[model samples]
Target: MRATEHWPVVVIGGGQAGLAMSHELKERAVSHVIFEKNRIAHSWRTQRWDAFCLVTPNWQCRLPGHHYPGKEPHGFMPKDEIVSYIEDYAKKIDAPVREGVAVKKLSRNGSGYRVETQEGTVTADQVVLAVSAYHKPKIPALANDLSASIKQIHSSEYRNPGQLPEGAVMVVGSGQSGCQIAEDLHLAGRKVHLVVGSAPRCPRVYRGRDAVDWLDDLGQYDLPVDKHPLKDGVRGKANHYLTGRDGGRDIDLRRFALEGMILHGRLLGLEDGRLVFGDDLTKNLDAADAVYNGICTMIDKHIESQGIEAPGQAHYRPVWQPEIGAESFDSVQAGITSIVWATGFTSDWSWVDLPVFENNYPKHERGITPEPGLYVVGLPWLYTWGSGRFVGVGRDAAYIADHVADVSREKTAVPVASRKETRPWHGLDGYNLASAVA
Candidate 1:
């Protein structure tokens, strides 16, 4: 007979989402156990580059009741500082977490769930799948075609430029990771070529305030999917390209051009012996500028509506270079020694035994999986723009905890007929569907 330890609730991940969920559960006086596949906030520990800091200001590092109490509110928090914050939060809250317990299986067992891990099995009435968005690094398929002599490392494996071979580095995918790695390599005295996509960019500080503050005040972070007028645009591209370096500084690709770094649009594919790029360099650059200018315009309106006196904001544009084509380059002719693929990541739901995902992503209104007694947190747009970020995830976590409390208080057992035939109930992200749902 398999030994079964029972928990009222079992939280799957130990990252920011999981920790925040655990904090809420403890506050509600709910009984639960947290299973962390590795140490707390493992991604922050292992995934980020050595010099990486959060793009969001320190004040936006809000999770539940915890706020950045540090003196530097406008400053960006570094990787180690984030890890330390997670560690301290776990300690202070006494988050009931089991480190190094990788959940091997999560499947429906009767009306609840049976979670099997390397350590043992846990039977819980509900499961909060707190796995974050990024686990695996997404290197392009074209990477395999690169010369074997050219060392290639995904941004996740990169610690510093010294870890790479001596020569110019070609950084691919101009998303957050791509841009940062390119900046890092350039600053390290290596020749850098940045291959950008249609990723958006914004100035770090606008109108004497951090760009995030402007977005935050304009409700960009809190708007719902339908309420957002630019749903197509929001869903079209990845998050805006900006950096948190040097106490919130703007990271424009054009500036990189001025500093002698070559820039390209999107990487097409490998030709005979070179890399082909698309002709959308100017198009992509324009998209980035639109995002920056759009936000500034919104901020300007907000200031006017409230009759608030604000300093005049300076306008910035990318400097065109006659020396650079601002386009394609053959890898060999470009003297590219290595390639850093900073595209993004793909989600792995193989460990889950239920069919709750669409396109490898958990399909739910928000965080809800059709299954009852189930919940998810920390997914992009799971609840709001801030769902995946630490700033507002605590709110979603609390919502889940409330639903769990309600479910636990009920004396009636869910009839086998009405329950989702496939899985169980996950704390859905939208309106407290629990009242109508329960």
Candidate 2:
């Protein structure tokens, strides 16, 4: 039998979150390793479209000690540049990352964790799951029913217009990815059919500054999930649609509709060789516009309240409206030769053999779970709106590192046998403390 290696802390990811955690752990002199299935910044390099860029400005690229160093503080970095930024941060921190080592299982091992990776098993006093929630691309079940000749592809696989078969492209879901991908196809002069969802929209620039800048000033990003009106429910909300392409600009679905883009409602499924859609196209569009104007209204109030001299702005006015859209259309007749499912992703935590999840969602107060030494970071709305983004992941990482350090101190101060008697660690409802400690 191979002897299991051990470390004080083990982080399972090599993205910005894991790198940030490594930096903080190193600062505190905590010996650790980051296990990445692929190379650092793999998602940014492989998953994103060619023209993809940050919707938020480059200044928000604050990952630990590294911040955006380019001349354009407000300009958004394209896909390649974003990858370089993360790679540069990894080099700067000297993070102990083991590339191509996929973690197969994570289970309790005598008051610590047993992380089974492809490379080998390792025991760690603390484990931080820095992998973000987007683990698997979520395509609807209806997709399987669609004719295979339609050339279906998830938004992650989509690269450019030239890659698809010649004909119109139907994009389903209207979240950030769906909207942006639709725009990418439209700009390429491809006939585009978009299935709009309830995802909200935000203006790229408002009141002579980016909407994000105003939101930052308004203390929106700092608002914690616990204090949020929806509480943890905010995590499930689709991100507001906008674009950072070509400097930055608003993604006006209404304008796209006006400019010959066929807009449909929610994808109901396939019916008798035809694609069925709901009649909520107008409703969805109106809801998106409401959010766009709502942000503008909020920014307008902030400017007035702060007595700041900013340019005035008018609320968005819908330039187009659908008139009783068809309930179902033959995709073949409509010339939609390709379909892009921009429908988000789902979390897969099956490898984590612990009872820390409730209904597929990890239950935690920030990154600290009921499983004492097990922590999760880089999750959407982990604490605040910025918890998962570059603007906020470093702060979350720092907090987790501090907790890990404290736990290390406790373990060092107390002997293993005495820890059970003096510090009796209680388990949550579904967890077994005795087994965890054993």
Off by over 4 Å in 2: 411-438
Q: TM-score of every model?
A: 0.90, 0.93
Q: List lDDT for all candidates, in order.
A: 0.78, 0.86
Which pairs of residues collide in model 2? none
lDDT of 1 by residue, 91-149 (tens): 87888888998999999989999999998887999999999767788888878888888
TM-score of 1: 0.90
Candidate 2, position 192, lDDT? 98
Whose TM-score is greatest here? 2
Give the 10-residue window scoring lowest on summed lDDT in candidate 2: 429-438
CA lDDT for candidate 2: 0.86
Winning candidate number (lDDT): 2
Record all residue pairs in model 1 with backbone atoms less than 3 Å apart, i.e. clashing: 371-424, 371-425, 372-424, 372-425, 373-425, 374-425, 374-426
lDDT value, candidate 1, whole model:
0.78
Residue 254's lDDT within candidate 2 is 83
lDDT of 2 at 241: 84
